[model samples]
Target chain A: MEPSDLAGMALIAVAGPEDALAFVSSGASSSAALEQEMNAVLNDSGVPRWPGLAAALLRWRPRLTDLAPERDLRVVERLGGQLLVPEDPEWPVALSELELNEPIALWVRGRALVIPEQKRCIALVGSRDSTSYGANVAMEMAATLVQRGFTIVSGGAYGIDAQAHRGAIGAATGRQFLPTLAIMAGGVDRFYPTGNEDLLRAVAENGAIVAEVPPGANPTRYRFLQRNRLIAALCEVTVVVEARWRSGALSTAHHADGLSRTVAAVPGSVYSANSAGCHRLLREGSAVCVTDAADVAELAGAPGTQLTPEQLGAPAVHDGLGVEDLMLLDALPLRSVTSVDKLTIVAGIGATAVLAGLGRLELLGLAERANSGWKRRC
Target chain B: MEPSDLAGMALIAVAGPEDALAFVSSGASSSAALEQEMNAVLNDSGVPRWPGLAAALLRWRPRLTDLAPERDLRVVERLGGQLLVPEDPEWPVALSELELNEPIALWVRGRALVIPEQKRCIALVGSRDSTSYGANVAMEMAATLVQRGFTIVSGGAYGIDAQAHRGAIGAATGRQFLPTLAIMAGGVDRFYPTGNEDLLRAVAENGAIVAEVPPGANPTRYRFLQRNRLIAALCEVTVVVEARWRSGALSTAHHADGLSRTVAAVPGSVYSANSAGCHRLLREGSAVCVTDAADVAELAGAPGTQLTPEQLGAPAVHDGLGVEDLMLLDALPLRSVTSVDKLTIVAGIGATAVLAGLGRLELLGLAERANSGWKRRC
Candidate 1:
């Protein structure tokens, strides 16, 4: 790596991710230039200092002397992964939407191209304590989406996330492109939630495991929440399969909605607490209703995709008869025939109109003439 | 009855209900004048001929000679009920929204005040083959709405309609106003669905049984479809509890939508065939999601009615912490103390930030100082 790239990585721990971007964008050349500016502001002797510079300098000065970029690079290389700065050719341009909050570098454990274009990717996420209905729906949706040539993205946690990945990997047959990607809250070197170790290992073999934090870092609660933003930004659509009234999946949905991406939620029984959050999203109008893979495919706008028309039950016997004919048909007896004069009073219509309407009904095979008068055809 | 009113009753069977309304609205004065106009139009057209006039005259002539308005009134009176024309003071003004399609007369078997003001009425209707989940939800919603001082209206059918009436009747303790109204497709003299005879009788005792047709009329299929409009028109809001893909309940929802009334549908499992129609309405954006009574009450806009705030689970321990403090808290060990120097690296922040954040965390009872270091509190 170049000296400037190394300096950017070292600055990540000193000034924090957001402020580090602010310092780099302020026309500094390298760590040497940044050090000189910090020294100048500390002595109160030289160039004008920006607001919050003093407080930031206090935080940066202590960490600045201890940053070891070379050792950080060596550790990742030893794990058979590589550090990817924004200048690298494989960096995702979609991260640019995050602007100043974007990660300084990515630690990748598998194929770099696993993160496909936004339109070709979707994130399926939900509660970690999901019911079997939610798990089945998530798995089915993921498998169908994979079969349609789209990659699935998730957090690599339990429940809906694990099911989504399993469905994608299970359906990936004879396909050259990877079927799934996992965005980790900690390091890609070792997956958190040790119960998912084997599943994530299989994930790395078939697709990719990525993280913003350095190797050996723990997945903290704050990092888990921040990780959700990456999953939201990496895909064109985010679907919440099932969530409780208050769940982490809702945060992911809100982030996707904030980015103006398509958000969808599956409907469940009103009696199920696990589906309350999904219904809340539907009620708030923040997410459209998504039932199956066809609904999701249409929302993703795949090439030549349209909503599959709803399957209708068999048509009723008198489906297309008009109002007057329907009334006449309703008045006709099934076992016996009655005179037209009596029918006029029973149906509450004119006799001439009843005769004409009966003729039309007979042509449609809905009415028949008996030996004496008219009766309904069964 | 007045001469003009009796003439209107006889005219109902000659022309269809809507055309009878049109003829009466055309300033014909009485049945005698209507006969003169029909005679004039039949023989080479003495007066201006309306479109469909000759056909209407042909139907009207045969029924005119046998008209028996007094016998029809006597039949209803013998059944301990009364016929209500549009000119009656007890007629609902809300039906005016139906305009020319309004019923010419209503056969009522209970209190005249059963069909309350539109603002105080709501319809809860669904499929005749509803699941237990839908039945329970309908019952609960109807009872709660009744307790909130609202009347429930529905088709006098089997499944959802029967349950709604039962719930409302069960909750109507010492209430002066009727709790429910049944709009039937047949004569009010006898309930159509024989299986629901006792339930329909109970509905009549507590509220009313109403229909457009006179005594001895069968509940024909066409009349059943048309009865949905009356339920839709009688209420300010229509809520579908559960329905199949092609259920007649959806027709009522569409009618309510056409009248610009509030429409709501309860959500259920996608696997359930009974909920498919409700989901279709929600997916098509024709109905809002309704889970409980508060949602329906808010939609009904009762006086001083507002939606109850959502019930939330217990707050998390780290809820109020900022991003930096949250990062520090995550970095702190649960079972052991760690120095600020170590935390600075683990949290990816400066030493000054780590020390200052720990002070704030300690004050909030989240961090504790132990043996010259800090650790997370239980």
Candidate 2:
């Protein structure tokens, strides 16, 4: 696209992501066409403007004359990044679920954002003040999911988010798919939290760092909230690893749930304040309880493709014993011997049944002959 | 009741609790009547014996001639205990939910087993090998529930069960209700695991220690499992505090679920094996996630009586702010100053809205005047 077209969309985008959608919905092809209609409305002359268009024009006109998208595009290009419009095939089709609230464009840095037709993207998010247990679970879950052919998405913030990104990048050795994607609230040109600069840069090298706003935009609080919708919209499942009783990650989870995507939460110590939000989610029936990667994969994978029953713990010695055997075993003396006749009376079985059960228990090494009768073996 | 009647019922009970029920169901008032019926069946005379009654009488016949109920009653009287039949008002009506499988009698050692008409009883059971986290939670939950006038029921074993008993006993000072009840697999006369003898004795003093079988009956493995059914049957809700991947407590929870009783499980660290059963319950949708005492009370209480929503954590600074105020607050810089005109453009609000929002933020101590413009307050 020419600099003029980039400037036209950027002018409308400067107001906010939603404003651009409104601009296009007005039947205006570009900012210039919208300006013509707005001017006509101002002079009380042309077809009536779309509802709320007049007020929106008032907000965007001030930004249109002052901003320079050519310079912003040049800045992103110099940083090896590209501006992605909704028309780009690289755009996540899942984001269409956002409907009218979808982002106008995505300013992406690093390798092209490739979400395949299978839509194997998952979002792992949590509190910035995560416990070591939460962080380890997040990292391990991310790595294992990546190994199983899923792309990880997260906010480029601290704690569980950073661990998730690191796990993805570290586990991407010799893998074919994009390792991870970090959706930033700030400009793609700058990683907001200085502490995670290296990790975010590594994320860009492996996959992409994306933002809805143009270059040099600050990561404002409102923008941070709006950014969550993007993460929720881009993924098929959102798993909250850990969160405080009140957290931004919860909002992200709610967003995913609102879009009818799968929402899963990892449960942690009931005593930990960091886990309270997760427990809250579980209590609300808003999220499935996830323990490990297989649980999440089952939630995100195609129907019936990954629906294997969870493996039970190692079997115990007496797991498969029959009813009479169990009854005879229960009646057997642990430290002293009891006669077979007494065992029959104690175990509520006949003498023949008791004798037969004792033979079975003896063969299984659960019972043994002691002195004149039977006793439980060590 | 006469000594002869006690002798007859005791003779039938020697075979098992079920045998007593079967004898009564056969229209035989006593063991002697049942013996006469069996003779008639053998001689091909009188009405055919009820379905399995012929086989059942064979199992009871040997024990009927050998046992003595009068002697058993004397031993219980010496121990200050009593034999409670289902016909007594003190019998828990909830056990009737077991239908055909209800225990025919309860040998109780403690304050009379008084499950009030309202049925304020809940079962808390878990693995004997419990973590400190599980123990603490179990104890706290028990104490709080006892204070709230609900009786706690648990298997008389170690770990989580003992802690629950202790919590209830300690918290029952000056309270009228029975603190806790221990449903034992063995006879109420003997607390099976000697390690918990002191605790069990205290429980009997405050609430009760009850068993289905007669005195001197060993707590066989089968009895332990059968004991779980009684626990589930005696309570309106069953909570598994912590359990292994395959635990007896889970069996109790499933039993409660099968009986249409509410089943709740406390959540814990995903990595802790002690919590695996609980997670499994949550995953299978068999149990609600319970954290604190209030949660258990709500589950056990009368519907709509204790339905208070959980209290949220302490409020944060940004809570309840309107959308425009949030936007304006987000536009304010941390260590830098910006004019109202720039704030209007960045926050995407009118200058008047920005000025009003700034004043509100200043009043809230979130923003303040900086030299020539506005910036965020510390």
Candidate 3:
């Protein structure tokens, strides 16, 4: 190993996050350079120590001597993963925007594909105990977004997160690089929540499994909170599908909000406890409510761009409709069947006009007669 | 009948809405005074006629000569209703805010009680073909608002409207003057949707049924749209519980928005067709999402004051909790059970702290362990 690599490994092993941050902010090019500055501060009687620096250096000196950088490198290589430093070509530059809170290095498992532009990367997160309604919404949104050439990023946990990864994988068309990415709290060598082992392995094979810690690190409570900031920093927009009040997903949303990234949340029934966090976010003006892939795309700065020619199958015959017919068509319910009387009320048109419009729509294959009355065709 | 009454009736019978508006805006206190101005307009050849006034006068001349005010009065009186001119003490002053569209007179059924101040009235409108979810939200919101000393106002149609009135009646405590008001599209004497006859009659007994036209008139498509303005004008806030795209309830919301009244909408599942209009309103920045009565009340300018001392039974023991405990309590799911592990994730705190907080909450009867996990108590 190079001397700089050995020094970087030692610093990561012994120094606290704030210590590493201070070292980098001082313009130290390498761990050895940072150590030299620390020694100068310690040796000079007149020079005052920076707040929290001297104490951290004194505390970490003994531990740095015990760390084995070569052995750690061997373990990472044996697990088919690699350590990524700031100099690595595959390093995500967006994390640099985090400044002081940025990770010193990243442990990555999977192909070292180039990180796409921020606009094409999105983070989807939510409650681990999400309802079926929430899970379905997350899956549909992920699949549709992936097909639109956007990469999906999420935590590889249960419920909404797991569904998001599965949806992206299912919708992969073999064209986009790294269709999904899972940022884990623990080491990339072992997936937490053993129940998601297969899913995480699939993700590692096709996309990436990433962590801030070295190999053999266990997922802890504090690490999860730290992991959320990385997800927020990596993407242009972060969407919360469903979260009860205080759900960890909200932490990701807040971090995204703090970073000035677009934060969108999927709204659910007001009565659903699982949606309480999302509603609170909407109520507090912290997040915009997004219903589908188009809404998400719009928030990500790509408005009016979700529906391409190939995805739409065939062009709709909307040009042929008159003003009244167009109003009636827009009034038609997408799901529930509606009657002529109700249609007249909804369209604010006369019964005769509504009936005539319905007839025209039916002939055009845009509407259909149901037992209840009429419905819009999918 | 008096001569003034005859002239007033004659003008209503023959003049177009614009002509009537022009006559009213001319500041003529009595029908006799308006007739003198009409004659002056006719005698002067050089003076240009106000836009549509000349054509309207020519069209109504013959009809005015044939109408009888006494017979119209008898028709209204025989139906156990009364006519309310602008001179009547029971007139709702808020309708004046509509300016050009304000009704010349209101035919009112049931008791001629004084119309409450605008701040005390609320309008709840939605699709006539409502889902069970929509109806439930409407009913709960209406009932809760009524219990908080606000009158519920809505169209007396089937689905959401009927449920609003029923909920208000069910929650009446006999403390407020009028518990509910039904703004009819047709004449006050004849209910438009016969299915709601009993409900409308009950509303007439406990509150009032108001209309712009005289007795024996049928509800027409144009009248329904016009009637929406009255509902919007009479209330301080208009809440759309559920509406499909282009539903008439949206007309009411638009009118309310135009009048600068607070427009709120209840959010539902994205998959629900009934909530599509509400969601659209939220997306377009036309309405705010409202979950409960307190939310509606807050937008109506009565923030944090929904529940009365008598209604609260006993104050919650929240003051004793520390900051972290309060956060955990707020994060607790109202309906769905949550586990301690999930709580820790949501609170972004240590698992040990969450476990300790849960134990304290259980002891205080604020939270309890459920089949799935922990949940807040009602």
Query: Which prediction has the highest DockQ against the true structure?
Result: 1
Q: Give every collision pair in model 1.
A: none
Ten contiguous residues minimizing lDDT sum, candidate 1 chain B: B1-10
Interface RMSD, all candidates in order, equals 4.9, 5.2, 13.0
Cα-based TM-score, every candidate: 0.85, 0.85, 0.71
Q: Give the Å error, residue A153, model 2.
A: 1.0
Residue range A1-378, candidate 2, lDDT tens digits: 111122233344354445664553454534556556444533442234333444444344445444778999999999899888877877767777775456777888876555443368889999999999999999999998898888899998999999999888889999878889999988999977999998988998888898888988888787888899988988888999999888999999999999988899999988888898998898888999988888888888644445233346667788899866888888888899999878867777657677888999999999999889989998
Candidate 2's residue-wise lDDT over B1-378, tens digit each?
111122233334344546654564454533556556444533442333332444344344445444667887887778888988877877778777775456777888787555543258888899999999999999999998888888889987899999999988989999887889898888777877999988888998898888888888778788888889889988888999999888989999988999999999999998888998899899888898888888777777644445323346667788989867988888899999999989877877656678889999999999999889999999
Worst 10 residues of 2 chain A by lDDT: A1-10
Rank list by DockQ: 1, 2, 3
User: Candidate 1, what DockQ?
Assistant: 0.39
Q: After best superposition, candidate 1 residue A244: deviation in angstroms?
A: 0.8
**Could you tell me the fnat of model 2?**
0.47
Task: Name the runs in model 1 displaced over 4 angstroms.
Answer: A1-51, A59-84, A303-310, B1-51, B59-67, B78-80, B303-310, B349-356
Clashes of 2: 0
> How displaced is residue A271 in candidate 3, in Å?
1.7
* Weakest 10 consecutive residues of candidate 1 chain A by summed lDDT: A1-10
lDDT string for model 3 (A280-369, tens) is: 788777888787888888888875655433323344456657755866787788899998876765554556667888999999999999
TM-score of chain A taken by itself, candidate 2: 0.81
